[model samples]
Target chain A: MADTAKIDYKNIFYPPGGILLWIIIYLELLTFGIALVFMALNARTEPEVFHESRMLLNTAYGAINTVFLLSSGWCMAQSVHFLKTENFGKSKLFLKLTLLGGILFLALKSVEYYDKVEAGLTVGYNVFFGYYWTLTLFHVIHVIVGIVILLVLGRTLSKKPETLKVEDYESGAAFWHMCDLIWLLLFPIIYLLF
Target chain B: MERTFNATWLVLIVLTIISAVFANLDFAYAALIILGLSFLKFIGVAFFFMELKRANVFWRVLLVAFVVLLLTVVWAV
Candidate 1:
């Protein structure tokens, strides 16, 4: 039998794998959930106030963003699968595709914000708008951070194709997916509920 | 072998589409129904696509507990 007792202790805590990374990703998710609960409770108490303010939102824009995030998550998952199989070239391609999705989401969000401003529906418009913009924008910022991480990871993977990149890529993808999952809740609450 | 087209995903998608269609119906609890369906879809995705079904028992319990807590809060509010 092969003796499997000689394990390296120095690198165990921050394993070359993604366990620590996932812990951080899940921590962010927990924070997002807490924020969501706080906002939802505030909205529940003032349905009419929130509804009137929610009218300022563009459902089409929200829907497009949702699609963008979902597709980006799919791309990220595909990239992880490719990386697991050592197909670094295909993995890079999928990562770039995912990055494009993130870029498109941000561009659409900017246009939506511009339209909201033109329609005189600023954050001060109402409490609902306040919460809506705050939550979505916070999620947008997370998306931007996620994209930056992906871009960096992409650059690294392209340079060192043989390195164990799957864990980092999967952790980043999980974080982005959490962002999308939150928005899926936020969209109907802030836009369609009214 | 794990199947490619998850029946859970298909069922959840159908439920979601139905819920969306029902949202247009002039019913008193249509919104509640939609929200419930959305929650169900969330569970389906979490368990299947996210591979939570294969997670450790403690993690699975934690997820269910959190979900129940959220639902309770929603109901209370």
Candidate 2:
């Protein structure tokens, strides 16, 4: 079993993935949070346009992407759990599943983007589309970066699972979950709410 | 521990579906309801999936506070 006694819960610098990773997490959240707040404030000025633009978004697509990220996050958490337990095989398996979920999410998002462009719902379409393109595209970029991180982690796990530090694994998982969390905020405000 | 992760994932999925359905309907507080559901999912992921529950209380409080601040701003605006 893993040495739970070694964990320092009270130490501010000893959270999972170390304090440095936590700093990155906080900064990323703050950045996205500001963008979202701006979007909300703009929505207040043009409620009707916001509402109509929100209506044009496909809720089913947003919801499906949400599920993909959440499920992938679960796989990530599981992969970390298995790593801690020294179950390298299961850990690698779950890691692959996490990658699959992320790839699927990006694939679906590409399709959605294609449809939006074909319909002329480009970035310059309106204030709402501007926010929509900016926020979601920024989020998509994060997801792509997250997938690259996971890919590197997966390669290490395959080649040298024993050398993979639990802290590093947790950091990757934390980053992936950040993507999911941002989507959680974005989907509701941009797709559901006016 | 595995069971806890499984349960959290299920709850998150259920909440996502509920919020999607809520979004499709018209009501006075539909926005509030949908945003509220998203809030719960956010907590679920942060605490369970992110394993912040195992971290210091400071981290937990910081995350919760961030979400609350975001939601409050979104709702008020």
Most accurate candidate by lDDT: 2
Query: What TM-score does candidate 1 reach?
Result: 0.80
Q: What number of clashing residue pairs does each candidate have, in the order they appear? A: 0, 0
Candidate 1 docking DockQ? 0.27
- TM-scores, all models, native as reference: 0.80, 0.97
Residues A27-107 of candidate 2 have per-residue lDDT tens digits of: 988998999999999999999999999899998999999999999999999999998888989999999999999999999
Q: In angstroms, give how far residue B49 of model 1 lies from its true place.
A: 4.1
Candidate with top TM-score is: 2
What interface RMSD does each of the candidate structures achieve? 5.8, 1.0
Q: State in Å the error of residue B42, model 1.
A: 3.1
Tens-digit per-residue lDDT, B1-77, candidate 2: 99999999999999999998888888899989988998999999988988888888999899999999999899998
DockQ of each: 0.27, 0.82
